[model samples]
Structures are given as structure tokens and as C-alpha cells.
Target: MLRIHFAGEDIGRVRIAAGPVPAWEMLLSLHALRGPADHGVFGPWRARTLGVLDASARLLLRLAPPRGYSPDFLTPTADNDIDSLVDAVQSTARRRLRTDLGLLAAQRGPAVWMRPLADGDTTALRCVGTAMFRYHQRVLAPAWDRIHAVVMAERAARVADLLDGGVERMLSRLHPHIRWEAPVLSVTYPVRKELHLGGRGLLLVPSYFCWARPIALRDSGLDPVLVYPANRGLQRLVEPPDTSNGDSLAQLLGATRAAVLQEIGGAEGVTGTDLVRRLRISPASASEHATVLRRAGFIVSHRTANTVWHMPTPLGRAVLERDSGVRAGHGCQRSPARAGFTP
Candidate 1:
């Protein structure tokens, strides 16, 4: 188990990443590609990425092991910008690169590439950075629109949790494997370890492809970061239902309410403003319809940062499926516009 000792200041300092870090996602996605059997959700993506990677890009696989230890410099922070992250990796301090690469080599056994890296070769380091950038463009850039939307929705949910019950509640519910016990947050890790925050606090990052368990930085001396799996519902965002039986449901619920339900059903965790924009209706109309749907138990809405996010309940999905005679997972294609959303 990994025990995280938190100071008082750390409580207020706790933060959620606004979106996925491109480099981090690339690293984890590469790890996922190594063992497709372990992560079924990413099966399609793994196949697609495998078909594109070249020998040079494949070299980056050495930087991340399927289990345990990845160089810290590869993933700078929670920043969503890929160029900035690539810049950080390329400009990493020679000593930091040597130390992190040495540790990675030690854990996974030395690779031929490590010789140049350990010698503080800038060209070798830039090669690794180039590989990471190429991998990101090939594997993650295409899906970034869907990825960003899901991540933003996740952030909205966590922000709601923070608002509802403060930091403790949010921390406790971060993942099934994590436990918050006031001053210390314990994580069931593959290896036994303890991290003392010493009031620097922790940055919680939600990753769409982080797999089953939460991951933390191996060297506690660096700023603390915890990358956890995003919600299961996020998987649906990857292949959003194109069309729903909204016409039939619209008859039962008014046209507007049915349209709202269809949109909520198509994508879970959609905000009222999102609905307003999609439906081309006023905010008040969207909120009113959503409230009625919530009262009828078709959907549930949670308010976070003054914005309300709506998601269909099982019954709501059932109602739409039954009414439309269109089963879940079968729908129209997603609009190009729906593919991206600002977080």
C-alpha cells in the first residue's frame, strides 16, 4: 500500500487536472499497447496505434514499462498543451534525465539506448522526445476531441464532489482502490511505498487510458502527481450514439424534453450549457426541461461551479431504447462539431 501523509496546507492545495497531459497519455497508451489483453476498452485504439508506429517511435516503449517506473521528465505536469510538454522533455536538465533514465534502465534492465542517454547525450534525449511527439500525433491526436470532452466532464464531476463534501469526500471517491483517512490517503499499490507530501500537496490527474489502478511518481522528491482511471462512462464518449429514437420519446416527453433526453442519452455528463448550445435553446428552457426529466427519474443533474451536468439514469436509457426501438450502442454518426468542446 502507498500511504500519502498530507499536511493541513495540502488539503487546500489539492487540485484536479483540467484535462489529460498529452505526453502522459502517450506514455500510458504505449504501455496499454504492450498488453492489449489487460485493457479491453482500448482494443480498437491499440490496433490503430500498432499499425502506425515505426522503429524509431517504438524505441519510446523502452521509456515506459508495462508495470513499474517511467521517466518523470517525459510527462511534465497536467498541462494539456502537447508542444509545451514536448519542449519540457527535450529541454530536461541533463542531470535529471540521467537520474530518471538510470532508474528506468535499472528497473527494466539496460537497453542499448540507455548508453547514450546515461552519457547525457542531447541528441539521444531529443530522439526520445521526437518519438514521444510522433507517437502522440499518431495515437492520441485523432481522439483528442472525444478525450478532452470526457476529461472535462470528469473534472466537472470531481469539482461537484469537492463542492458537495470538501476535499475529503472528493479524495475518498477518486477511485475504488484509494482510501482517504484524514491526514493520510492510502493507495493499494503494486509495491509497498509511502509518500510524505510535507505540505506541497498533490495534483490529481484523470486519464482516459490509465487502466485499472492509479499511478504516482516513483521519486517522491518531485512534485506529487496521482494519475487515476477516468470514469467508465467516458468510454461511451469515444463512440457517441449518432441518432436516438428521440422522435418517439419526444411525443411522450414534449419535443424539447425528448430532444434533451436524446442528447443526454447520446452523451452522459452533458452540461446544461452544452444542451443549450446543441439544441439552440435558451439556458432557462434547457434547465427547465432537465429539471422535469430529473423529477421524473429519467435523468439526474448535479450542479458544479454553477453549471449543472445532466446524465440519464438507467431507467431513462431504457425508456429511450424502448420507445425508439433502437437499442443502446446503435445511433447516428457524431457531428464534427460535437467532437470537440472547450474544457
Candidate 2:
């Protein structure tokens, strides 16, 4: 279990990122790509991404294994813009690079190619930056609009939770695996760990690529953040629109539940009372449909005292957009060729 100890003032300092962190998304998506192909949601995305990767993309795979430690310098403090993030990685301080690379070596043994990186060679850093930029342009950039929409939807839900019930309520509802009990917030993790936020608070970053559990920075001294999966937006990132499955949301969720999703998506921070009155349904029926939508990753519910607010997730919004003929098509573009990274 990972336990995060919070100071009294830390609660007030907690924040939810308004959008995705491009660098973190790049790194985390690499990890997802390297994972098992049996993933039902991400399998299609993996296949599409793998078909387009250039040789230099392998450099990133070595640094970020499917499971285990990834170098901290690869992902610096939260930067939403991909260009700025690539710049940050390329301009990483030599001392920081050595420290992070040394840690990676200690855990997974040193690699011949990584030796130059550990020594902070300028050429090595540039190659890494090039690979990152290519991967983003080729793999992530096409789907960025969808990715941003999903992440923002998650942020909207979380922000409503924070405003409705403050830090404790928001923390408590982050995930089923996460638990908030006053001064400490505990999370299910592969390894046992503890983080004490000595009034630095914590940044809650919503990620479309984070798998099942929340991940924290290995170096606790840095500004702390917990990147949690933003309610399974993988299908949006991977799958193409299929008109064959017409009104699929209604078909899968049933008429009433689909209606519930549509109504919730039409507005922001809709309360359960609003559903009851607008839909002309009993409170129990509204609650039941909302529960079904929440469980399906179509919506998130934030409660305030007696009121419960429901907001649509990206998946839900996409479904509605598709039905309404409002969804836009984006084309994939290859990254401009650059000098290759040679060992």
C-alpha cells in the first residue's frame, strides 16, 4: 500500500490539473504500449501505434519498461504543452540526468547505450528528445483532441468534487483502490511506499493512459503528484467510429440509462434532483441509472451533503457526439524525419 501523509495546510493546497501533462502522457503511454496485448480496451490502440513507430522509438522503450522504474528526468514537473516538454527533456540538467539514470541503472542494471545518457552527453539527450517528439507526433498527436477532451472531462468532474466536499471528499473518491482517512491517504500499489507532503500538498493529474492504479513520483522531494487513470478513455484514443453500431450507447445502456447519460452530458454539474425533476422519474430510478452510468465510466458523481452532481466522461460525450453527427474526423500525420539515434 502507498500511504501519503498530509499536513493540515496541505489539504488547502491540493489541486487538480486542468488538463493532461504531455510529457507524463508520453511516458505513461509508452508503458501501456509495452504491456500485454490482451488488454481489451488498449489492444487496438497498441496495434495502431506499434505499426507506425520508427526505430528511434525503441530508445524510449528501454528507458521505460512495461513494469518498474522510469527515469524521473524523462518527465519533469507538469508541462501541458508537448513542445515545452520536449524542450525540458532535451535541456535536463546534467546533474539531474546522472542522478536519475544512476537510479535506473541500480534497479535494472546498466545498458551500454544508456551509459552516454548517464554521463549527460548532449548528443544522447538530443536523440532522446527527437524520439519523444516523433512518438508524440506519430502516435499521440492525432488523437490529442480526443485525449484533451477526455482529460478535461475528468478534471471537470474532479473539480466539482473538490468544490462540493473539499479535499477529503475528493481524495476519498479518487478510486476504489484509494482511501482517504484524515491525515493519511492510502492507495493500492505494487510496492510498499509512504509519502509525507510537508505542506507541498499534492497535484492530482488525470491521465488517459495510467492503467489501473495511481502512480507517484519516485523522488518524493519533488513537487508531489498522483497520476490516476481518468476513467478508461482508451477506446476513444484507439477505436475508429463505426456507424454499424448505431445508437450504441442506448443499445448498451438501455433507453433509460442512455437518456440519463444524454441529460447529464447536456449540462455541467447536474444534480440528482435535477434528473428526478427533468426526467420525471422517481429518485430511486434516477439513482439506479446514474449508478449504472458511473460504473460504465460514462459519468462521475460528486456529492455535496444531500445533493449528488453527475458529469459525463469523455466516452459518454463521444457517444453522444457520434449520435448527433457532431464528432469530427482527424487524420494521422507522420513526424518530420530527423537525425536518427545510433548506438
Candidate 3:
């Protein structure tokens, strides 16, 4: 028997025989696919999905107070202490979420499908995938929960903050596009143990891949399990093959090619005219660069509603690394050009 309690806004440690998925996992999933699906639902899918995810994330942050975060924390790719980096990343992401409730609520409800604020025709899952890859590096890796008690001391008020403006407009706007009545047992409690699914039981814990996906434990019946992001051991493998050894690599990924990578990841991912808006380049320019990168094994540009989106290759991250501060080769030696690139 499991005992659950919500004191005011506090969720006492929820101890399940099987653990709940990490909050980050759910965020990543929704973010990964904030684009339209094959059904071609047009604008509504991305908007509604994001609204759902944004809603879910707010709920989770409330439960998992930010802990052990420090100001001077370094990025995971940096040589600074690993633990501090993690704390910083987690803390920063939480802070960003806290302040961005307005953006979340801005695009609410099921009717949002008729005209989603997202403006994309790309599949939401692909968008979420690339976004997660970046999110893990840019946010998750650096967030080590060493001092959770401090950063997230105040209970996150996502619901109160967004829900305050009157539910009538919000839900009514979304009512036409979404189905809230469905059994949505959002599996996002941060402190759960032992998850039983279907006829199986599984263990959940933190690890290199612990912050991956939040499965519907009850519906999927797969028991509780930790999921690793898909990039896994593949991130480094994607580097542009160091073709700098020859012009071969550059022959493939040029400045134009790199820009495509930036565009796709810019506002996470966009489609239709939104893609043009995000890339900030003309349709021809976007198409040409995308074509080149796709040929060179650097990007996967997809089109819908007359717009294009790019998904970076593992090599894409490396290509961006010269600017990213991720020490790949030459053993972290700081070049005078890199100012802070100390050994």
C-alpha cells in the first residue's frame, strides 16, 4: 500500500514500489516532439503538446525543490568540478522555468491546435530529440543535485502563477484542442522507488542516463526504469570526422551548413513560416544550406507547411564545439585565441 499526501503544496516523499520518472525526462519527451505528427494536425499539435509538457514540468518542479545549487558552478564540458557543474545546470534550468510561466500559459488549450503559437509542421518528437540533446548538455549535465535544499527551498508555484489569471479563458481556449479527461497519470514524482508495471517490477536510480524518459508506468506496465538520453555514447561519435585532417570534413560542413544547425536548434525547432522566422534567413538560403548539410552527414532538414527544420548530427555538436567550449581533442590546452582555454 502506498500513502500519498499533498500538504498545502508539498508532496511528501512518494515511495512507490517502483519509482517515478525523472521530471527532466518528461520535459525532454514533450520538448522532443513539440511539432506536428503524421496525422498532419497542423498548428494545434505542437501548441497543445507544449502546453501539456509545460504544465507537467511546472507540476514536477513544484515537487522537486531545487537542491544544492551554487552560483559558481561550471559547465559539465568544462574542466571544473563535475558535481558543481551538475548543480548549476539543474539550478539554472529550474530558475528559467520559474520565470517562464507566462510563456507556458501564453499558448494554452486544445483550441490552440487551430492556430498554435509554435508555427511549425515538423514532427514534435524529432524536435524534442534534438532539443533534449542540447538540454542535457546545456542544462542537465551541469545540474548536480548536491544542494537541493537551498536552490529549490521555496516550493515552485507553477500552478498558482499561471492558473491565477482565470481558468475560463485558458481552458476554453484549449478545450477544443485537447482531451483532459483521458487517464493522464503523469508519472513525474521525483522521489519514488520500486515501480511495478504490467506484470513486472523494475528499479529506478540516477546514472549517466537516469534522466531520460517518463513512461506511463501504469499504462505501459513496464515497471519503473531509468532511461538514458538517446545521444548516449554517440555524441562524440558525431564530430565532423575531423576532416580538418583533410578539407573533406569542411568540404561537407561549411559556415552555411553550421548556420542550419543553429537555426533548427534556435527556438528549439519550428516549421512552416515559423521555420523561416526562426532561421532568420530567406527560404532559398535555408534550403540551400540544409541541402548541403544533409548531403554532408551534418543535418536532417525536414519540411512541412512550406517550412524547413534542421536536426543536428553528433558531428553537429562537435562542429559547434569550437565555439561551445567542449574540449574534444588536444587535451584541453588553452590557446591564446581561446582566452580562457587554460589547461
Candidate 4:
């Protein structure tokens, strides 16, 4: 169990990452390669990726074992962009690199190839960066659109929770394995550990590649982040919406109410006031629509101070996802240029 103790100031500091981090995704994808083949969801992706692995990819696999620790230096928090990530790893200070690599070695046995990296050889760092670039382009870039969609959908729900009830409420609903109990957030982990936030707050990062439980940085001294599995619904991402079914749903519920449902799902943490403005409906009408949605279990409304925030429930999101007009957009911004390493 990993227990994270929070302070008073930490309540106001919790944040969710805007999008996926390429460096973190790269390492986590490698770990996914070694996961159980019967997981069903990632089976097809795993087959396709494994067929394309090369020497450079294998070099990374040596350090990021399926079941154990991966050096933290590989994932830099300075920025989330792929280009920045590659640069961060390549330019990592010798001391930090040496320390992280040393920890990796201590956890897993000594590896002869890791010697150069631990010694902070510039060439070895370049090789690491080169591997990351190639692996990302080959493994991640192809399916990025689908991955981005799923993660963004998850983020929207989480952001809504944060807006509705603040950091405490958001933390409580992070995942089944995570429990937020007042001053401490307990997470189920394979090992025992404790982390005191000391008011730096926690960054909640939703990851497509993470499975089972959440993962945290080994070194507690770094900026706190919890990378948890995003709700996949991958098949839904690729399939075309059934407009006929959506139209039927609209008929069953009043057309106006259906529109309200779509609007609630499409918008992140919309309020009754926002609904009134966006839909050009009267305040009472907006409240009525939201109340109906909430009572029917299609949406959840939370009162925050003077305002009440609204978001779709899983069932409501499912209905909206089937509507062609409510298709989710990609969350991660497009990279300015394809990232490359000059090894």
C-alpha cells in the first residue's frame, strides 16, 4: 500500500495533466508488451508492436523490465511535449542520471550495458534518446488518435469532478485502487511506501498504457504525480456512431432533453447557467432539464458554493458517444514537428 499524506495547502494545489506525456507513454507501452496476453484489450496492439521490435527497442527493454522499476530520469517532468522529452533525457545532468541508474541497478541486478549509462557517458545518453524516438514513432504514433480520444474522455470526467467538488472530491474518485481519506490518500501497490506531499500537491495524470493500478515516481522528492489507467472504451473510439439509435433516443426522451444530454456530455463540467446561455433556454428550463437528467441517473449534479456543476454519468456518456454529433475530440495537442534524436 502506498499512502500519500496531504497537508492543508495541498488541498488547493491538486491538478490534472492536460494531456498524455510522450516520455511516460513510451516507457509504459514497453511495460505493456510484457503484460498478460489474455488481457484481450491490448492483445491486438501487442501482436502488431512485437512484430516490429528492433535492436534499439530491445535496448530500452533491458532497463524497463515488465515487473520492476524503470529509471525515473527516462521520464522528465519539465515538459510533456515529445521534442522536449527527448531533449530532457539527452541533456539530463550526469549526477541525476547516475543516481537514477544506480537505483535501477540496485533493484534489478547489475547489467553490463548499463555501465556506460550509469557512468553518464554522453554517447549512451544519445543512444537512449535515439531508442525513445524510434520506439515512439513506430509504436505510439500510429494509434495515437485513438489513445488520445480515450484519455481525453477520461480527463473530461475527472476535470468535471474536480470542478464540481474541489480537490478532495476529485481525489476520492481517481480509481478503485485509490482511496482518499481526509489527510491521506491510500493507493494499493505491490510494495509498501509512504509519500508526504509537503504542500507541493499532486498531479493526476491519466494514462492509456497503465493497467490494474496507479503508479508513482520512486523518488518521493520529485514533483508528485500518480499515473492511473484511463477508461479505455477503445472499440467505441474506432466505431462509427449509430445515428438511427441516437435519433430513437431523442424521440424517447423529448428532443430538447436529448439535446441537453448531449450538451452536458460534450461540455466539461457545465453548470445550469452555462446550459441556459449555450442552449438559449430559460433558467427554469435549464434547471428542469438538468434535474430530469440527474434523477434518471443520466447525469450527476454537485453543488459547489452558490453554483451547481453538471456532468454525464457512465450511462449518459455511453448514450452521447453513440450520437454522431457528440464524438469526443483528441485531448493532446498536435506536435509542432515530428520528434527526432540526433544521436
TM-scores for all candidates: the values are 0.73, 0.76, 0.26, 0.71
The residue ranges of model 1 lying beyond 4 angstroms of the native Cα positions read 37-39, 234-258, 261-343
lDDT of 3 by residue, 1-343 (tens): 1111122222222112111123433233333343334322213333334443333243333222222111111111121233433343344433333323223333342233212213322342233334434433443433323111111111111112225543222212221111222111123344343332322332322222222332222212222332222221122211233432344345444665555666644533334354456657787766666556555554444332132334554445445655555455446764666565422
| lDDT (Cα, tens digit) per residue for candidate 4, span 214-294 | 999999998998898874333221233344334333343687888888888887457788889888999999887776665
TM-score of candidate 4 on Cα atoms, chains taken together: 0.71
**Candidate 2: which stretches are off by over 4 Å?**
232-236, 240-276, 279-343
Q: What are the clashing pairs of model 1? A: 242-332, 243-332
List per-prediction Cα lDDT, in the order shown.
0.75, 0.79, 0.33, 0.76
Tens digits of lDDT, candidate 2, 207-318: 8888788888898888898998874434345555556545444544477777788899998547788899988999999988886665555766654335566777666776
Question: Looking at candidate 4, what is the lDDT of residue 231?
Answer: 45
Best by TM-score: 2
Model 2: lowest-lDDT 10 consecutive positions: 334-343
Pairwise TM-score winner, candidates 2 and 3:
2
Q: Where is model 3 poorest over a 10-residue stretch in terms of lDDT?
A: 149-158
